[model samples]
Target: MPSIIKCLSYTLPSNVYTNEDYYSNFPDVKSVNMEKIGVKQRHVITQGQTASDLAQLAAEKLFLEHSIDRNMIDFLIVSILEHDYYTPSTACVLHGKLGLQKKCGALDFDLGCSAYVYGLGLADGVMKSMGAKNVLLLTTSVLTKTFHPKDRNSHFVFGDAGTATLLTLSEKENLGPFVFGTDGSGFEKIIIRDGGTRNPLDKNSENELKDEFGNITSNANFAMDGIGVFNFSLKTVPTMIEELLTKASLTQNDIDLFVFHQPNKFLNETLRKKMNIPEPKFVHCLENTGNTVAGTIPIALYESIANGRLKPGMTVVLAGFGVGLSWAATIARF
Candidate 1:
């Protein structure tokens, strides 16, 4: 018996923001069911809300439900594509918010999409040898507040939410092997063009241009080559999962549940069909919370376990891909 996912919980803002109603400002809103895309209405943060605020809410919920003694937790890891501030990691803010004093180690990892598996691996290692019995992993994506409302391509798809998962060394559970991959060359395939040191806001104005649709287009704004990302996912995800299972000496049949990142309803369905996985084993949470970046899979897992869709002793496969052109997979025994 080693470290296992003892329990997990997640939360999202109560508001829902979508381009569907802003027909005048954004003309591309369609009638398609948001659920069809793996999200119905995504939670929207209220004005002045920050990523840390959402994360705090989720962490508090998990903390209260488990009644975990904050001092017993040894490490805190925060993963986010966007943070509330450029300085002092969001995890540090969460530490102060929770008032968990004791100079517990805090780290911030800048990753998009494939972070849970990566973070879980790091947490598992820390809890085993750090003289700590528990570790807290929190992830949040507040892309909704970052993207301009006029940008229809990204506005309707991205959502804001936060999730927390507890990992601890326990005697009554099982944990599985992990497999990870990255292709930095395709990093530009899905990215936000501006706001980084490479292309700071101080750059010349002429370098930017507007699209034919009159939308101010820049490398800084979020632009995703949908077709390219889709092809990358469908072609690479199955192989990644296969290799993960192989390392664990398991197979598709050995897994009772398949929890992949909620990229989109259409893409998930396509990959599911390609992998020949039955619908019953797949977990989809796009309806209520849209694509929550790093928050998607964990939130879905938390909901499933809470609703009894996931039970103890069940074998589950977790995979995540997107942003950073990165992908990761790991098998877990629930």
Candidate 2:
């Protein structure tokens, strides 16, 4: 049995923030052309909202649009950079909120930009191993909440959103042959320093400090080595794509559309041009969504299908590289 993507749906927070808004909030922040980054505006969750809330909204939309029965879904997999709580998995919480049957399996995985691709692989493996028929894969992030309001390096780079994808067992193999890579040495390239058990919060963790860029943040806030991440992506992503193409026995031209994680306009364009992927064949959806971490790829896929860039029988390549120094690429036929 092969995993087939049945449908994709996404939800964005109601609050809108833009580069101009950042400038207004932090006048000392270095000025950068928003066009170059490919983000004019980003949606952010307002107070009282959580990633699970966004995930639930997206899942509800999927259920309504596809008329899917909650009982029929055998597994629920959630990929998120942050969860609402520390104990129970977000997937289990979602399972109860959605009124899924007690027989359903649920779990959560911590991942960043590469989450959607990884979730697809996990779903395929679980379904194949357990003979499960249906799986709901949800990817989401509320990374903005972890960034200091004055942290220019990260505050302007992330947005809040969630995506829900349905994968069902089919005779035809529409997904697989994935290539994955990890470089834990670059783990510090993007990270939150004081939240996990490794570094529990303390007085110093909440104390604000200034970075070289004049961005102020606490040890508890999200911090990113922008230059380091840029270099890592340039070095690893293209090679991963090539390896994936080789694994799938396909070439650049064979893929009808290339959907890479929407980290930023510059990095994405750079990778596309390096791979010699023509403009029409590349899909970029970060203009209004910003970098929604794990949500970027699926949201882009949803928009691609809605706009007719993706269709049944069309082959698409999905790649994601980011936090954890992790990256993955895979081929799927719609």
Candidate 3:
């Protein structure tokens, strides 16, 4: 059994936060590079939206536009950094909210930027082994809630969104040959320190502290090692791409499009130049979407198809890197 991505859909809240909003709030942080990050605005969850809600919305869109029958879906895999509850998986919540069949299996996985690629691999294996026909892979992120309002290192770079990609068994496989890498040593590079079991939230966790860069954040908020992340991408992404190409027995030129995690404009452009890939062969959709963590790659894919950059039967190389210090690359035929 092989998996083919039949459709891609995404949803973002209507609330818009512009770069000027960040600048207005942190007047002292004049040196923050908004242009380099390539995001002028981002959609943010209003007061009540959760990651599951966004995922459901995206799935609804897929069902409507593609005329997919939800009752036929056999498995649901959701990738998200935050969950509505610690006990129940977000996938289960989505399954129920969408009124999916009771026979459907659901699971949630914790991952960041690399999640979409990982989800595809998981879906393919599940479809083959379980003899299932349809697997719905959902990746959602509401990272803005994790960020401290004044944390210049991460606030402007993240956005809130969710994506749904329908993977179904087909005579021809459109996905495969994934290469994955992880470096736990860099786990602290991007983390939310106070909410988990190890560092259970306390009153002290709310104490605000300012970094050398004049950014303010509390222990309960998300923090990032910007330099460490940048260096890691510079070192690992190229090698990952090369390894993926080698594993798939293909050359760089054989790929019609390269869709990597959209961390920031500068990092993505840097990776493209480093890979020696032409601008037209790469997909860049971060100008409006920002980096939506697990949702980045799928969102990029949706935009690519909409803008005519991606076409049916085209060979595409998808890669994602970040958060778990994890990276993955795979080849897919559209």
Candidate 4:
């Protein structure tokens, strides 16, 4: 028994887009360094859909294919910063959708890119502590729903998707020495100016945002200081990975694949260059799916396992950063 990923599944919205399509609508859109990112396309969820719907779809697939009884799941965690509603918790909504209403304890976390790794760490700790057998950790984020079409930076780069990972107890060793950290001081680097308690879409607030043409984009839209985000990400992500390797008592040579939050092609390349990490081991899926926010790591993991980039008994390093001014990394033998 391996307390590792027993089975993993992903559900990407049945829509696609290209750089040309994204850039033509907004000329100022910073060009995605497609070649470097190794993503030729990405899936985009349609309008009028919420993150919970995507998570449920993916979870259903996981259960049906694996024949997992929903009731056996003792805990269900939905890792995401964006939720269908702030009060109900996306985990509860997903539990109902999956019909795990009775035995499951559900909750949502407000983590962005780092959600998947953090979710894995959290799930592992709780499951072992409580003597549970199985835990389903699901993550979904529709970056497009919060994206303003006029916001070139995010609109061109952010795609929508959901992923589900089933973690179970093992007779062997569990995933070891996870490395996670946060820096709230730079929280504004990736800020959604409106729609939260800080700037709720209410009359008491004076929230406003304008597009490149100087027209008001919308009262509710996401905003990021791209330069600050890029600088922070490039610096923090590689260092975290190194720390994770150290904790595992391993070095860069021990990793078989490196999966990271699909932020963008430029950032990935820059980080690799600065850290001297091998190019072939760096896994990214930005072109096809853009940045799926918190969903990228698992989605990329599925792709890697499917396409033979990863195999059984291989050591994979997972790292994610962004949005909460957060970052996390972990090394797993699959």
Residue 208's lDDT in candidate 4: 51
Which candidate model has the greater lDDT, 1 or 4?
Answer: 1
Stretch of 10 with least lDDT, candidate 3: 25-34
User: What are the per-residue Cα lDDT tens digits for candidate 2 across 223-330?
Assistant: 888888998999999999999999888888899999999999899999888889999999989988899999999999999999988988999999999999999989
What is the lDDT for 138 in model 3? Answer: 92
The runs of at least 3 residues in candidate 3 whose Cα sits more than 4 Å from the true structure, single-residue gaps closed, are none
Q: Give the TM-score of candidate 3.
A: 0.97
- Runs of candidate 4 with Cα error greater than 4 angstroms are 27-40, 202-219
lDDT of 4: 0.79
lDDT value, candidate 1, whole model: 0.80
lDDT of 4 by residue, 1-334 (tens): 3468788888888877776676677665345443454555667778777788889988999999789888788889888766777577778877887888486678788789888999988888877776667889998888777666666556666788888999988777657678888898987777666676666686733345764545334557677777788889877887898788878889888888888888887788788778887888888666678788888899889889889898999988888898889898887778
- Residue pairs in collision within model 2: 313-334
Give the Cα lDDT of each candidate.
0.80, 0.89, 0.89, 0.79
Off by over 4 Å in 2: 29-32
User: Given candidate 3, what's the lDDT at residue 246?
Assistant: 91
Clashes in each model (backbone N, CA, C under 3 Å)? 8, 1, 0, 5
User: What is candidate 3's lDDT per residue for 21-117, written digit by digit as tens?
Assistant: 8678766665455677889888998898888889999999999989999999999999987888887877888899999999999999988989999
